[model samples]
Target: MTIQKIIRLLGRFFRPISLKWRLVWRLVVLQVILLTLMIFILLGGLTIAGVIPDNYEGRAIDVIRNTITKDGSGNLMLKQGPLLAELRKEVPNLWFIAKDEHGHELSEGTVPPEFKHITEALDYIGDARFVAEPGGSRTTATVQWAEDTAAGKVQIFTGAQGEFHIMALVSVTPELFLEIILPVGGVMAVATLLVIPLVVRSAFRGLRQAAVLAERIDIDERGVRLPVERIPSEIAPLVRAVNGALDRLDKGYERHKRFLIDAAHELRTPVAILNTRITSLPPTPERARLLQDTARLSTLTDQLLDIQRLGRQAQQFTRFDLVAVARGVVVDLAPMAFAAGYEMSFEPARGELFANGDRTAVERAITNLVQNAIEHGGNAGRITIAVNSPATIEVSDEGDGVPAAEREKIFEPFYRLRPRGHGAGLGLNLVHEIMQIHGGRIELAGSDRKGACFRLVFAQA
Candidate 1:
């Protein structure tokens, strides 16, 4: 595959792993690079310290081969100059005995008497190394043949006293890395990898605690702060900034809530007075419409007040009979349903069906559903509030049900299926929030029969 595809695949594979693994991965990669660089560094250091031999052998061989030139009459000769002098410095105690296929021999340095008979035996081969202890002294040397343009195949028998040679380092590199460095590095890597999790967990404790606190900070639970003590300075700023932002958000939310509560309170007096005036008018189609508008306005004002009050309500969830709550709501709205030319009824279960929640909040949620149905359920059909088994209260109307497309959006604040619908649209949203607070949910229970069905599934006691 392409490099881009490989990178994408790697990204996808690693994305799901936590921060600990990512950090570990980066450290491991860095370790590999460090070890690779260490290989060459170790080689160079050992060769410099005379631990490995013949590191500069290639340069020595080239110098000796290139410097072997003819002196006018075309005789094999080892020319002496700065090049040979530099070779002596690199391979200290250097000596060579060169011979050709034509029986010509040119010797340099103190020709060890031990190698005199060995040179004839090495004539059959092009390259070889000999390590012998002659008269209690370890003698090491290399016998190699080089092809020269002027001189036919020159056999070079070379040796050095010191071990500083590039050839020896090159020869020992594979064994050094594979046998010594590889095993040692592998053990080090394994031990580091095994210990990394503990280090990471300890280091990230503050972050984990912060994440947990952040998760629990819902709309109601304001003023919650993440732990910043013992956090690394690099990440402390981000944590403090988040805390500051949350403080500002909480203050802004409180201000908005105060404005809504004050506006609702202020609107009640004027709305009541308007209703009184509209009711006193002579019975007519216009008066009826005005009264309806004023009633909707009053409901909206009450809903706004409910929002503020519920925000401050300390939740004390208890098991209560859902049947009674449903029946009470149906009885309360029976008069309104009757006045609106619709039949209202309650279907309570045979036994007390218990659900865990704030009783007052549950009642309000049920009331909102019934009220919603009455206002928008075509005003000419029956509205049923049924308390079923398994801690549920379902409110369904025998009118045109909510459209399939608008079902999800209806629970959102200020969303109305009809633009001119007689609702401030806070009713369903308020109920939804109530369910969320109770650790339950409100679901749109679609029915094969006509009309919309809204079900409130409460938490088990």
Candidate 2:
């Protein structure tokens, strides 16, 4: 497999394990491997430096030979001297048996019953020799030894019956285990337990700081960045990539805001010139119609600019009376409603209704809703502005109500229910943008009497 694929597979397998535990386990495995190498090195060094004797088998044979000899009657016998006692002290479970030339037992200690038949058949006499058999596979009986070789058997004995014979069986002692393996293993275990946790926690400290910094970043806080210094090298590239993406987004947003402002500025001069020329014409029906069309165009242009401004403007919030704003918008639009043969009225709340928001933006939004009601509330000729709570205002008209399917689309920018020339279709979209900037929302609700009710909900102060 490819290196990357193998790395990903390993990550998936180990992902469930906590970082701390993963580090601990790896350290422990390393310690075990190092300890094994140290043991091998120590043994090799001791042998090379002659600190540990390598001729243990030859020395043991010599000790056994010296401990056994023939009496005056030609029978084998064990010497009861300090030399034989010293050998027994050095090798735990040490025992010996001897036989004479006549095939008769002639020693103080007897062999285990299972080995009696085999010992009786031994018939050679020469230099001392040793034989080893794995415990379960022994030709005669079972014997236990040192912890590392609990089921092993060792025999150092003479063979054949024509002369003297001596047989010795022994198990290795615990002193070898204490001297060679324990000290090194104890040191390694202690180090792994004490040092790994602090090391793992220190390594992850940078990642935690990066997480806290990332959590606080948003569109408004685009300039903020996670610090790469002191971060682990393994994760530095990912953090850099995220910061790069944020930079691109901030640049694109600024460019869009600039284009909207420039376009609005460029259109104002031509629209004003058009209005002036229409007024200079002689008084006639055509001239009057041109004047009306120019006024509509001017209104549309203003709405377009409002849409652009509200799209980028951050809300400047203050505590203000929402009911007062709704009443003011109704008063301002009262002349237009009367000219369109409609009656307009504002139902003021019993008490002042206050909300936290930009007062000018809220006033513009209420104006748009009232204008939409005047245009679409077909000849039923009645519009009502109501303040239901500190954070809510509803404008309803007496006209053919909006269709269920078309209600949502009417709020989209430049989307109108009717064809061109009836309205510019930016009114509701501007209102929606204003509500969003103030951290509020707008919704179209069904009116029980007729027509549609558009509700503006703001955050309460």
Q: Give the deviation of candidate 2 from the true structure as CA RMSD.
A: 12.6
Candidate 2 lDDT, tens digit per residue, 268-323?
78879998998998999999988888777788878877776663344556788888
Question: Model 1, residue 4: what's the lDDT?
Answer: 100
Cα-based lDDT for every prediction: 0.81, 0.68
**Candidate 1 residue runs with Cα over 4 Å from true position:** 1-22, 32-92, 95-159, 162-171, 218-220, 282-284, 312-319
When superposed on Cα atoms, how far off is each prediction in RMSD? 7.4, 12.6
What are the runs in model 2 whose C-alpha is more than 4 Å off?
A: 1-231, 282-293, 308-316, 379-381, 400-402, 406-411, 419-422, 446-450
- lDDT minimum window of 10 residues, candidate 1: 49-58
Please provide TM-scores, in order, for all candidate models, with all chains considered together: 0.72, 0.58
Clashing pairs in 1: 53-163, 54-165, 54-166, 55-165, 55-166, 55-167, 56-165, 56-166
**Tens digits of per-residue lDDT for model 1, 1-27:** 999999999999877878788888777
